[model samples]
Target: MPKIPECDRCRFYCGSHYLVCAVLPSGPDGKECHHFAPEPNAEPQELWEPQGARYIDDELVIERVTYNGEEIIQPPQRWSREKKLWLLDNHPMFTGLCPSCGAEFERDFTARVHWDCPECGWKDDSV
Candidate 1:
């Protein structure tokens, strides 16, 4: 059988002809081209995500709100990059103290974002 490897992936592919490759008009020397390069603009793959979904730390976050037994999907509120970094550094769970007041306090489970300092009345404006 004739050696005709898939030319569509070759970087030298002219994109007009299905079998015609740029390296050799006829075909590869043997089963495949010795210097076959991948096409820079090959068929792009489509990426699909659920509405109101976002990626955080390479993980997708989707918010689904249900009311009256009906499922309602809403996108999670976007947090600024600075706010995220501040949380990672100064949040009581990580540092065990208010970034502004330096007073150690337990973090509220429901309110994990910006917090108020009980000792110095310092308001966290990062998040």
Candidate 2:
């Protein structure tokens, strides 16, 4: 009697040299054994992860959004490398100076939401 792969993990396995399992003593007919029963003290299986996702440092890192009691997975948003560098170079909030008059804003310009320049009368409406 040849033992199948699932015979070792099945609870009904006889574990004897003469008999294979109590359910099917002569061994199962096919690979898909319907009478195969799992052991109660078996080790837990690995977690199932969806496509395009991965585990990092034993932690699952994925972007998920809940809508209408359903969870939707989506990729995280990020600015392009070139666009971020451009913002650091051109944007007044980072530059701390008016683009038109080139007048320097106060050191605490980041605290102020509005970037209106008093020198050139430049109104900041790009909110």
Candidate 3:
């Protein structure tokens, strides 16, 4: 048996160490197996700013909507490299850089959102 990467996104690990089994088959060696199939990982999704007010069952939701008719949702705010560097220097939870482009941005955990990198359009979802 080969070591496999721990997958924390599977639902099977609901209790008892929350142990996630290897998604890959073939004994976790990336080999071929009859049951070999990629397990669904709960990868986070990007949250984009909505364009309009949303209503459900004739009830209005105010958490994500604005008071006016316009949808003033949370959009990425632009910051200069200096600002990013400052954040990197000061913040404790900043993580990984985008390889597509060398732009940096902060992840807001409280909001569960991330601002898109100004230099490149990289988005972080696990903020």
lDDT of 3 by residue, 12-118 (tens): 22212222243432233453333333338555322233344334433433344455777565444466579778667543345544545755545554653555666
Superposed model 3: Cα runs more than 4 Å off: 1-96, 124-127
lDDT of 2 by residue, 1-127 (tens): 7778778778988766467789889888887689988997854334456554655544566857788999998675465679778768866788878778899888786468777888998766553
Count of backbone clashes, every candidate in sequence: 1, 0, 0
| TM-score to true structure, per model | 0.31, 0.32, 0.19
Lowest lDDT block of 10, candidate 3: 11-20
Candidate 1 ranges beyond 4 A from true positions: 1-77, 107-114, 124-127
Local distance difference test, per candidate?
0.65, 0.74, 0.43
User: Tens digit of lDDT per residue, candidate 1, span 1-127?
Assistant: 2334456666776544344556676667677677677777786322356567754433566867888999987756567679888788877657878777689877564667766778988776554
Query: For candidate 1, what is the lDDT?
Result: 0.65
Write down the RMSD of candidate 1 (Cα, Å).
11.5
RMSD of each: 11.5, 14.8, 19.1
Best by TM-score: 2
Q: Please name the candidate that would achieve the greatest lDDT relative to the true structure.
A: 2
